[model samples]
Target: MEFRQVSDLNFNISRVTLGTWAIGGWMWGGSDDQLAVGTVIEALEKGITTIDTAPVYGFGKSEKLVGQALQEFGNRDEIQLATKFGLEWDDEGNVQRNSTRERILKEVDDSLRRLQTDYIDIYQVHWPDLDTDFSETAETLQELLDSGKIRAIGVSNFSPEQMDEFQQTAPIHVCQPPYNLFERGIEKDVIPYCKENGITLLTYGALCRGLLSGKMSKDRTFNKGDMRRDADPKFQGETFDKHLEAVEKLKEYADKNFDKKVIHLAVRWILDKGIDSAIWGARKPEQVTFDNAFGWKFSHKQVKGVEEIVETIVEDPVSPAFMAPPE
Candidate 1:
């Protein structure tokens, strides 16, 4: 695995960070606790030093599993651990957005206990809390930083305006947003702002929820509990068809130019865009191996080919009006 220096934070992060959402067992179709723990160990053995998770993921189950895995390894300092807070899960399985000082403090303590670590390397706000003042959250995070509970601070799923608001109060070291060949909405604002402000872009949804992998068939139907089946726009009827058309073109390019699978080509295309790191949602250790080997370098021609192909079919990100509730 390759590593990149997030200049602002001065941490050397793996170019491909392991995402623990799938293992969280709340959104993904299949999850295995043993597999999740083994995958983290496997990733560490392969030199992957970054692991991203959230408190809401499995309602703290994910953090507990991660903690167990790290304890087994007995080398926590060798890795950079990142986890998030902000979203609250209710009894009805609904997520309530809250970033108030009291909520954040409670959540961080709970995460620390579950993670089995004294200080998190990177602590991120899962998403913006419009109902609360940004300063309130920022100040709370600053207190955590001052108290030595966290080394760096970040925000996930934040719009450009929200990012600016948080930055005005605190120095943000990283920003996690969904960016892929199919989702280029960040190009309009978020990406540029991060580049200009020296903030690292740690992108998720690099595979468009597995669409770019070319594994989903037109007849494929997700299980009832799978989150993507219900929420991801790219998996829906007409949108899925359009995305598949684009993936077919990408496959053609991959075959002719790289002699590699389309998934590798897809991941490499995003890496070539100057993203600091790509967080992959892997459920099994084998998936981590596949993603780790999915070529990080691309030739100039291959890069240009991806740009041309993506520009042909990519559309603006789904408007806020179309967004589904967060899982």
Candidate 2:
């Protein structure tokens, strides 16, 4: 496993972070606790030291499971517990952006308790709360940093301008943006801003929520609770077929040229794009194979080839905006 250092952080994050949203079982139907625990421990044993989760992910279930896994593994200091806050949920599973000072104040302690850690390595704002002043959120995170409740601050799904406003009060050390083979929206502004500002980029959805995993089939169906069945437009009718076509071509291209799977190519593409890390979502031990994602990269010509394929094939491309919660 490869590691990269983020600004203002004491530890190095794995180049491929373990995303536990699936294990949270919120949007992707349901999850098994034993499987989730096995998955986390397997990833850590395989050298994936950074695990990303959000309180809203399964409404705190993912953090609790990760905590349990870490406890069993018994190596707290070796792992980086990266979790998020600011999105409040209800008993019925409805969520809204709520980054108020009060929300952060309570969420931090709750996350620490669930994660079984006193301090989070990277605590992020899951989304920007349009109603709240950016300073209010930033000030609270600064206090957390000072109090040693969190070692670093991060922001997700934030516009470049919103980050600028938040930075006015506190410096951001890491930024989480949905970035992958299909979701290239952040490459325009967010990626450049992070590079120029010295903030490490830990991009999520390395497989485009299993689209680029190269294991999905047309006849395959998701459960009723699966977010892709409804929340994601790309999984519907013609849009889904178009992406599958691109995936097929990309899969063939990777196997023919690099002798690697599309999953490897997709993740390597992100790392080669200069991203500090890529969040590889997995819910099972077998899905945690990211060691091959490193030690290789797409050639410059191959990168352009990939763009040409996607831009030409997926005429009605979609981003991850549909999954964002209400403001």
Considering every candidate listed, which one attains the maximal TM-score? 2
Clashes of each: 0, 0
Task: Indicate the TM-score of model 1.
Answer: 0.92
lDDT by residue (1-327, candidate 2, tens digit) is: 888998756679989999999999998999889999999999999988899999988898999999999999988888888999999978788898999999999999999999888999999999999999999999999999999999999999898999999999999999999998788999889999999999999999989989999998888799989989968988888889889999999999989988889999999999989999999999999998788887777889999998888899998669888888998
The prediction achieving the highest lDDT against the true structure is 2
Q: At residue 29, give the lDDT of candidate 2.
A: 90
All models: lDDT? 0.82, 0.91
Q: Which stretches of candidate 2 lie over 4 Å from their true place?
A: none
lDDT of 1 by residue, 1-327 (tens): 678876566678888788888788886766789999998888888777999999878888899999999999878887999999899988877887889999999999999899999999888998788889999999999999889899888998888889899978888888998888877778889999999988888988777778877787889898676767867777778877777877888889888877777777777777788888887767788776545345447878778778787667755444322343453
Candidate 1 Cα misplacement greater than 4 A, ranges: 290-296, 299-301, 313-327
